[model samples]
Target chain A: MSLLEVKDLKVRVDEREILHGLSLSVNPGEVHAIMGPNGSGKSTLSHVIAGKPGYEVTGGQILFRGEDLLEMDPNERAAKGVFLAFQYPVEIPGVTTWNFLHAALNAQRKARGEDEISSPAFLKKVREVAKSLNIPQDMLKRGVNVGFSGGEKKRNEILQMALFEPAVCILDEMDSGLDIDALRIAADGVNALRSPDRAMVVITHYQRLLNYIVPDVVHVMSKGRVVKSGGKELALELEESGYAQFEDAA
Target chain B: MNVVVAKTGTGRALGDAFAVARDRLPGKGAISDLRRQAFEAYERMGLPHRRIEDWKYTDLRALMREVLPLAPQPDATALDRAAGTAKAQAIEGVRRLVLVDGVFAPDLSDLAGLQKGLTIRPLRDVLEAGDALSGQAFTADSSNPMIALNAALATDGVVIEVANGTVLTQPLQIVHIASAAAPGAIVTRSLLRLGRDAVATLVESYLAADGATAYQAHDALVVAIGDDARLDHVRLVEDATGAFNISSATVSLGAHAHFNTFGMTTGAHVSRYQLTVAFAGEGSKVETNGVNLINGKQHADTTLLLDHAVPHCDSREIFRAVVDDRAHSVFQGRIIVRPHAQKTDAKMMTRALLLSDEAEADNKPELEIFADDVTCGHGATTGALDENLLFYMRARGLPEKEAQALLIQAFVGEAIETIASDTLREVAIAAARRWLEARA
Candidate 1:
C-alpha cells in the first residue's frame, strides 16, 4: 500500500472550482515531481494536503497511513508528520526565530503526548542544525524572516524542514526568486532529508530544480488533473521542449 | 429674571467636598488662592462630555456619574498595605518614593543615601513653607477640565530638583499606590526640574493593592528641562479592574535639550491620559511612545499635543492599542509647527488592532505646519490580525489561542521596544503578557 493516496480530489476557492478531478499516489522513499504551468492547480494540491484554510474540498478523499487527512486541523496535521516548505516565508516582527522554532517543536510534542524538550537541550539541537545549514546565530536571535534577503528567507524554511523531520514533505515553488547559490543550498537541504519511510512531493513550474534533486517519477499536471506520468527522463524532455506541447495536448 | 444652572452629579459631589475641606488642607497663602481659582474653573465646566472634541470618545459625564469621597490621609493599616503593592512593582537599582492615599509615606520609601546634587521634598512640604518653586504656576492647558480638577484636590506627591551640571547615577522611581483600606477618590501632583547640562532618569508607576477597586485617581505632573539637559521618563499604570484613572503631564524643553518618554496602560475599567510637550528653544529633540492594552469592556484614551515653537527641533511619536472583547481604545495626537519654526521635523504614527468584531478603536493623527520649510507627516491605521500570519503560525503547530497571543504581543512590542532601558522594557513586556494570558 502507498504511504499517501489522493483519489479523485476536487477543490474550490472563492466560489470557483480550481481542482476539478486530481488523483495521485506516492509510495515511501519515492521522490515525485509535479510540473505544470501557472494556474494548473499545482499549489492548490499542496496547500489542500497541508490543511490550509479557505480551500473547500468538494469531492475526493486523502489517506495518510490509511487515516483521513482532511478531518484534522492544520496544527493536528502538522503533528501527524506533514510539512510544507512555503514559497514565501512570512516575516513575523517581534517574534524571534529561536522562540518560533522552540514553540513549534514543543507544541507538536504536546499534541503527540510527548514531553517537552528542555531549554538547554533544545538550544543545543537548534545550534547544531543551524550551523549545519550555515545559519548565523544572530539570525536565530532576530525576528522570524524579518529583514532577511531572498536567500536567507529560503534558507530559513529549509531550516524549519530540517528540524521538523516530517514523514511527508511538500516543497512549493521553493526555487522561485532564488539565486543559483541559494537554490543549491535549498536543494541540498531537501536532498539530505530523504529517507526510506518518508515520501516527498516537489511542486514547481520549471524543471530547473529537478536538476539538483533528481526525481524518481515525473507527472504532468494541467487544468487540475494529472495528464501524464512517466520516468525521470520525462522531466528532461519537458525542459528541452517547453510545456507548449503538454498544454496543447491537455 | 433669573437663570439657574444645575450642576452634574460628580461636579456637585467634588464641589461640596472641596467647600468643606478647604481650611484643613495643606497650604495657606498662595497655594490656597490658586486652588480656589482652579476649583471655580472646574465648577464652571462640569464633567467633560462628548461635546468636547478632546473628550468626544471618552465622555466622563456619562461614565462617572458621581465621584467617590476623598481618601483620607494614610493610616497605619493603609501604609502597611501600600508597602506590599509598591514593593511588588519596584525594580532594582532605583531610589523609590511611595505615596499612599495621596500622602507621602516616608516609612514605606527609600530616602537614605541620596545621590549628589539631588534634593527630594514632598509636594505638601513645599506647598506649606519651603520653596516658591512649589507654588509656581503650571504651564496649564486651561481647556482641560481634568487639569483643573487635579489642581484643586492634589494632596501630596514628590518634587525633585536636579542641580546644574549634575548627573544622577541611577533612576528614581515614584510608586503611587492607592490603599485598599480606603477605596475612594484621590489626587496627587509631582514636579521635576533638570538644570543646565544635567541628566536624569525618572520612572512613575500607578498601581493598587489587592481588592483595591471602586476608586478614582487623578494625577498631574510638570517637567522642565534646561539648556543642554537630558531626561528619560517611563510611566506605567496597572490599576485594578474597577478603578478609574485620569492623569495629565506638561513638559517644556530649553535650548539643545533632550526629552524621551514612553508609557504603557494595561489595566483599569476606564482611563484618560493627557500629555503636552513643547519645544521652547532651538536644537531640541523629543520622542514619545505609548501602548494601551485593554480587554473585557475596558476603555482607554490617550491624547498628545506637540508644540514646536523654535527652529531646528525634531519630534517623533509612535502609539499602538490592542482592543479585545468589546473594549474601546482611542489615540489622539496633534503636532503644530509655528510660522517661524523653520527646519522643524515631526512625524507621528498611531495604530490599533481589534481582536474581536465588537471591539472598537479610534486613532486620529493630525499635523499643522505653518512653516513652509518644515517637514511634518502623520498616519493612522486600524486593522485586525493578518490572516496570513495566523495561518503561518498554526501551520507550525501552535494552537489558535497561542498564535493569537503571539501576534498580539508582536503588535504591541513594536512600541514597547522604543523604551531605552532594558529593565523598563521588560516590565512593559511582562505587563502586556499578563493581559494576554488573562484573555486566554
Candidate 2:
C-alpha cells in the first residue's frame, strides 16, 4: 500500500477553489517533488495534507497508511507521523525554542503511548541535531524563530523536521528566501533524514533546490491540478523550458 | 431635568464600622491622628464607583454591596488550620512570617534566624509604642479610598527594618492566611524600611486556610528603599474561591536604588491589587510587572501608578492577564512624570487574552508627562489568542489544550521573567502551570 494517497482532492479557500480535483500518491522510501509556478496551489496541497484549518476539503479523500487522514486533527495527524515544514515559519515570542521542541517531542511520545524522554536524553538529542544543522546553541535559548534572519528561520524549519522524525515529510517552498549556502545546509539537513520507511513531498517553484536534494519523481502542478509527472529529468526539462507551456495548457 | 444620586451604602457601612471600633483599635499620638484623618478622607470620597475615572472598570460600590464586620481574633482551632495550610504553600529556604486572621502568629513564624542588622516587630506593638517609623510609613497622602480605609481599620501586621549596608542572603516571606470560618473582614498593614546600601528580597503572599468559609481581606504594605538599596518584592495572592482579597502597596525609591516588584494572582472570587511606586530621588530604577490568571466568575484587577518625581529615573511596567470562562480581568497603568522630572524615561505595556466568548478584559494604559524632556509612552492590547500561533504549535504535535497552555504561558512569561530571583521566578511559573492545569 502507498504511504499517502490523495484521490481527486479538492480544496477551497475564501469561497474560491484553489485545489481542483488534485490527485497524487507517494510510496515509502520515495522522494517526490511537486514543482509549479507562483499561485499554482503547491503550498495549498501540502497544507491541506497537514490538516491546517481555513482550507475546505470540498471533495475527495486522503488516506494515510490506509486510514482516513481527514478525520484526525492537526496534532493527531502530526502524531501519526505527518510533518510539514512551513513556507513562512511563525514567530512565537516568549516561547524559547528549547521549551517548544521539548514539549513537541514529549507530546508526540505521549500520543503514541510511549514514555517521555528524560531531560538529559532530550537535551543531548537536541544538541546533536542542532549542531548538525549549524544552529547556534544560543538560538535555542531565544524565543521560537523570534528575531531570526530569513536563512536562520529556514534552517530552523529543517531542525524541527530532524527532531520530529516523522514518517511523511512535506517541505513547502523551503528554498524561497534562502541564500545559496543556507540552501545547501537546509537541503543537507533534509537529505540526512531520508529513510527506507519514510516518504517526502518537496514542493517548490524553482528547480534550484532539486539540484542539491534529487527527487525520484517530479510532478508539475498548474491551476490546482497535476499537469505532468515524469522522472527527475523532467525537473531539468521544466527548468530549461519554463512553466509557460503548462500555464497555457491549464 | 432628571437628577441621579450615587449609592453609598458600602461606603457608609465601612465608616460606621470604623466609628464603632475606633476606641478599641491600636495606636496612639501621631498614629491615632493619621488614622482619624484617613478615615475622614475615606468618608468624604466614599467607595469608588463607575463614575470615577480611575475606578471606571472596577466599581467596588456596585460589586461589593456592603462591607462586612471586622474579623474576630483567631482561636486555637483556627490557628491550627492556618498552620496546616501554610505548610502546603510554603516555599523552601525562606524565613516565614505567618499572619493568621490579620494578626502576626509568632509560633508559626521563624524569627530565630533573624540576621544581625534586621529588626522585625508586630505593627500593633509598633503602633502602641508610638514609634516614629509607624507615623512616617503612613504619611503619604493618596486619593484612593481603599488605602484610606486600610489605614483607618488595620488590625495587625509586621514592621521590618534592615540596617544600612545590610545584605541578607535569604528572602523574607510574609505569608497572610485568612482562617475565618465566617463572612467577615481581615485588615492588616505592614511597613518595610530598607536602609541605604541594603539588599533584601520580600515575598508577600495571601492565602486562605483549607476548608475555610467565605471572608474578605484588606491588606496594605508601605515600603521605603534608601539610596543605593536594592529590593526585590514578589506578591502572590491565591485565596479561596469564596474569598475577596484587596491589597495595596505604596513604595518610595531613593537615589540610585533599584526596586523590582512582581505580583501574581490566580484565585479569589474578587481581587484588586493596587500599587503606587514613587521615584523620590534621582537616578533610581523601578520595574513593576504582574500576571493574573482568572477563570469561572472570578474578577481580578491590577492597577499601577508610577510617579517619576525626580530627573534621570527610569521605570517600566508590564502586565499580562489571561481571562477564561466568564471571568473578567482589568489592568489600569498610569505613568506620571512630574514637571521637573526631566530626562525621565518611563514605559508601560498591558496585554490581556480572553479564552472564551463570555470572557472580558479591560486594559487602560495612560501617560501623564509634564516634563518636556521626558520620554514616556504607554500601550495596551486586548484580544483572544492568535489562532495562527495556536495552530502552529498544534501542528507540531501538541494537543489543543497543551497548545493553548503553551501559548498562555508564553503570553505571561514576559512579565514573569522580570523577577530578579531564580527561585521566585520558578515558583511563579509553577503557580501559573497549576492555574492552567485547572483551566484545562
Question: Distance (Å) between predicted and true CA of A222, model 1?
Answer: 2.4
RMSD of each: 2.3, 2.6
- What is the alpha-carbon interface RMSD for each candidate? 0.8, 0.8
lDDT of candidate 2 over A12-52, digit per residue (tens): 99999999999999999999999999999998899899888
Task: Report lDDT (Cα) of residue B360, candidate 1.
Answer: 100
Per candidate, the number of residue pairs that clash is 0, 0
Candidate 2: misplaced stretches above 4 Å?
A: B1-16, B140-142
Residue-wise lDDT of candidate 1 within B200-281, one digit each (tens)?
Answer: 9999888898878978888899999999999999988888888898999899999999999998888889898889998999
For DockQ, the strongest prediction is: 2
Model 1 lDDT on a 0 to 1 scale: 0.88
